[model samples]
Target: MPCIGVPCTKSLVRSNKHHLTVSFFQATQKLPSVLLAAYAELDCGGLDLLQGELPQSIANELAATAKAIAAPGKGILAADESTGTIQKRFDSIKLQNDEANRAAYRDLLFSTEGLGQFISGCILFEETLFQKNQDGVLMVDLLKKQGIIPGIKVDKGLETIPRTDDEKATMGLDGLAERCQKYYAAGARFAKWRAVLSIDPSQGKPSDRSIAEVAYGLARYAAICQQNRLVPIVEPEILTDGTHDIATCAQVTEKVLAAVFKQLSDQGVMLEGALLKPNMVTPGSECPTKAKPEEIAFYTIRSLARTVPPALPGITFLSGGQSEEEASANLNAMNKMGPHPWALTFSYGRALQASTLQAWSGNAENKAKAQAALLKRAKANSEAQLGTYAGGAGGGGAAVSLFEKHYVY
Candidate 1:
């Protein structure tokens, strides 16, 4: 039997008969025309011989999770900073980065009253995902109680790709499938993997090798997460470490996104089951002229429109060293620009927590104050998601730059 547009060779058909196990009817029902054609060519006996589950169910669950996380008026809280990263944050407040202090701080954030109204999900460091609150309740349970979905950061940081101009690729793929399973069983319904790209024209930075590595790594990570029933937030973050202007950033961002989506498609990732966590187009951190939120929003949305598909559920903008107010304002500007195909929301760590952390400062007496600060930022970003934020919610830290050259995690 010959399949339309599919070269169903006798050897291929024989291999399918020997290895395929999904119910042919069910698998073919909603399959793409290409796959359906191939399946249609199968003998009745071959169809009956096929057994086991297909990715359709997993895809359904992933899509549902992605949609819920990208729901309107809600965004993600990126609390997934690694231990070393959080230590730096704690050092700024003159607080210890011990396990106890970390637990207490996260407890304060997760227990904030009505946090779910704004934050639909939170990306957790592995420790935080399994840590118990001081009250002895599981931390993930606290997030769930507040109606927030729990997600895990699965990447193990970055390593320089050989033969490249110091451009890096995210690691942690060795046991990703097993790790994702563990995370899913631990109550995480989503995962985050960040791929960093940098712009440096002098050396032809972000070489083709670097881009290919990043794209393939992200696509593979997304595939693994979806296989394990986790919606993957594909983050290809273009580092804001250059002296490039906003237009340059936009161009780089569009180029990177185009490569990313191509790899995702080539790897068979369902766009609806994935979310994009990308940097908003902006001037490099060292650039002289700081673009306003409106300008940032313009380039960001235009770049995304040109590269990102509507099938994606959302585009969660990373702070990428933007200030708290800057992040919120940029997000608001994008949404206000009206009708974009995907959700324009935030997945910010410092932008969402800088003020809150300052307010907390590891003081038990300041728990309520800190929680209020968390809620305030969450609310600001939430309103921004709907283009309703009026700004000024970032408090005194609003304009403070959170940039760290070559930031990790």
Candidate 2:
């Protein structure tokens, strides 16, 4: 007798020297075929000998939240930059990155007028989730008061995977279930885990190990989030840091997404309860050929259609290094070309915040101006989500390139 297939529970039982046993519950569990093959040949006996139960209500809640986050004419505001990353952003504005300053800055963004009209969700760094604003209100509560769902970024960031071509994988899985529980208790209804990959054919970049590491990590994170009653936004962002053409990017994106979905299935994650936040197909940042928004849209949708399952309710595009207007235009183009299976919106950080940060400049006197900046980008992106964006939200730093070479976090 031998064991075969993905493990459904955290516990493993060794019945004898050569036999293993895993409990099986059919009502709310799904075992993916690819994951089965990947974990095949375990020495076990009596696969379904033990009975267990997983709550179906979790699935219902996750699905509901995912849909709300993907509501039409809305997108996400990715204000989840880590403390160190926020330091760089603050430095650009000649501001300090102290806890109070950070809280105030986020308060500015979260308190913007009518943000929930276009932004359905706001992803928070752990610090922001637990911090109190100037008025002593919890930051998470600010988002909820505005009719927005709050999400927490759970991944610790990226680390280089040894024996690979400088490829990276996201860490932060240890105690993730407990952390998810805490985040849920703190008012976070959703969670995000970003996995980074880079393109460099010359260096054999995005190696097999790198792809598997990120895909598997994202799958496990998603499953854990769902188990804790939090909808997971699955983000596998391929960095725009090479000389590859749009076609090359498309090929890599398709391959990466295929592997990711396969792993998601293998982990028995409910597709209906998850959202995808991926990079749009575009020419590499250093490429000589600049792709039109239409071209980017065409390739992006084509690649997604070839791999992403229809069960997913949303596919939120990450801005990556694209400028604010470019991000909006590309999203607009995608919606113009759709009748696609999933809601194609945005989950932008720099593209959504750069101009606003510039406008604010750490001054309370500039609050109104900064908020206007935020609303403009939000409105632009919201319209883009519906293919009705007329364009031109650019001003100040909105059009500046936000790319950093081999960016971390």
Candidate 3:
């Protein structure tokens, strides 16, 4: 049979036959054209999420999860380092990077008294999700006991985009819905997937095709997560290694975000059910121009305003090689500016962990000091999220210059 006046291919007929067995049970609701397009990508990706309609129950539940994760004056603690990545970080402190040491370090972070005061959730590595601390309590239970949501890192890592000089994209979509389901069963209510984009017009990188391809993958991943009951933190991180000025950064960020949202809409992903994990607007690392916190805030908010959907509940800025102080300052400035529709918060990995790592140094006795260091950064960021942070802590943490050209994960 022909479909829509075009001769249906053999693959199309098989897919139609399968749909006959699937569509009878689906609840149908009218969706916008944008969502239909996004669903097209999801369908092509072979995910089994609801196609015609996103159930109101699912949408409402996802909205609540997103809101809770971006709670007022609270943000996420991004401890979702892969085994090897954390090893490199551990090596910096001259500490062993074995699984036990990693567990111990994470335990110290979660065990800190009053950690939930500032952190609303934690994005955990796969191992950390299943691993227990010395006391034999599951890490997810620990986070739950503290009223902190547990989320998993769903993306495997970054891979060089084919035919691109330096642009890259996130992988691990194969069987992602299944991974999200298992993560949800393990007490994770949200998940993160990061897609990296670089700006170097001179190299003709971040080509239009690269942006579209990455955006579609992210949308597909988001759809699958929501179907499996995980609030997807849609991250399209623009790297900061180029010598580009703030204007270039703003331009690139807007373009990338615009593409991302368009794909999400087309994929039928619910905007209210997701959070954005974008790099804060700033001059590139190699740029001579230094933008103040307020300047960065202005550009960041402006870019978001132009591109992001108001339906999204929150935006948790990624540190993206920024110093802990710089990241907090930028977030503070954004909150201080006139009200935005979505919550302005943070989702930092290195920015939140650097000082704590140096202070801990894998010493048992230094645990208190390390926790204090973490609390300090957490408190600073929490206050920043409310626009009340006044620069009390002055660069007292580890000197982690965490900048890589197109970094993976």
Candidate 4:
């Protein structure tokens, strides 16, 4: 028998031959076009329409977890600083700062009970990530077991700008994507990148170049993090400089944040999966008259709300040398007074850990008291996040002044 569309009769003699040939051609030619069209539609309308048409239960669960992490009254704990920074802090307390001490201190914070009630996640320094507790469990494992997501700070500290006498840029862009992938595999679900911006009234408002550079850096970092399936904490810190008043700080912060969001949008970052860690607006150290906590809270939130998008996961304020009580009080007031669009919480380093370190003084006997002090601050800040913090209750310990001229990178 002669074959149709085939050279051999044997080839054409297969069962359902005609249907098979048609199906093959359709898959080879027409099916690609059909798939392309579906993809185009998905690209235009996003996963919502696709999910509506084709059910994906996993996607829903992932989204719910993200929402819970960024929900109101919750914030991230930022413990991801370099050994050098931690050493500086340890030095202040007259303790022999070493890798062991660093690990111990972080283990203390991660092992605290009921942390998940307020802290949605923790950003861990590289050393602390793989370190084990006294019981030999990995710190990352400890955090996961307690329902807190572990994060890593990926920036490799700031580098001095070549010609700008006082300016610097954050490094760690080299191999960031791969680093993020490894961090994710190591139990980190998120990452943080901080770009420093200084207030230079001597040159008037921050230079357009400076603003654009930081914005672009943050956006690029966010994209890389998202590509690796890690949520990025985008932080463009407006350094507290000069005797500039709170109004000046607000203006500069607004400008910086606006630029950051514009770049974030430009880079196609998924805002729903990211967080913003920002400097709380406050007068500079040189500013003689300090604003009350209420004023600071009002201006800080008002400025942030003006610039940050509502789709952002959350906004965790950096203490920026504010006293522990001041930081908590300001956060408390913001929560109390707000019609805030996003959660206002803390990612403080010095403000949160300074007191605890002092109380500990690197002694084994002081462990319980140190842990209690740490928990006290954590509890106070947790309460502050809920807007019910009454001042002078938990954070009554003597304050540790970590402020020095140009303290940050």
Q: Which prediction has the highest lDDT against the true structure?
A: 2
The 10 consecutive residues of candidate 1 with the worst lDDT sum are 45-54
Report the Cα lDDT for residue 3, model 3: 34
TM-score, cand. 2:
0.87
Candidate-wise lDDT, in order = 0.83, 0.84, 0.82, 0.73
Sort the candidates on lDDT, descending order: 2, 1, 3, 4
Ten contiguous residues with the weakest lDDT in model 4: 17-26
**Which digits, one per residue and each the tens of the lDDT, describe model 3 over residues 1-409?**
4332224565433222213211111111112223534644663331225434566556657767897987888999999999888878888889888989999999999998999999999999999999999999999988888899999999988777788785677789999988888988889999999888888889876799889988999999999998888999999988898889999999999999999999998988877679999998888898988998878887887688679866677899999988788888889988876355678899999989888888889999999999999999999999999999998563654334667665666
Cα lDDT over the full model 3 = 0.82
Model 4, residue 79: C-alpha shift (Å) = 1.3
Please give, for residues 2-119, the per-residue lDDT of candidate 1 as tens digits: 4322355554342222132112222232333333245446654221122122244565577678889988999999998888999999999999889999999889989999999999
Model 3 residue runs over 4 Å out of place are: 1-52, 398-401
Q: Write the per-residue lDDT of candidate 2 for residues 106-220, one digit (tens) a residue.
A: 9999999799999999999999999998889999888998999999999988888998766888899999999999999999999999999988888777888999999999999
Per-residue lDDT value at 222 in model 4: 86
Query: Each model's TM-score?
Result: 0.87, 0.87, 0.86, 0.83
lDDT of 4 by residue, 1-409 (tens): 4322334445434323212222221122233224324544664444334323212332232334455566556667778778777777788778777777877888877877777777787889877877898889899987887788888999888877665655767888899999988888888877889888788688654777778878988999987887777778888887776789999999999999999999988887766567788998898878898888777876776686568766564678888877788888889987776434566788877777777777888887887777677677777788888898887744455354446567653
Candidate 4 overall Cα lDDT vs. reference?
A: 0.73
Q: What local lDDT score does residue 150 receive in model 3, on the 0 to 100 scale?
A: 95
For candidate 2, which ten residues in a row score worst on lDDT?
45-54
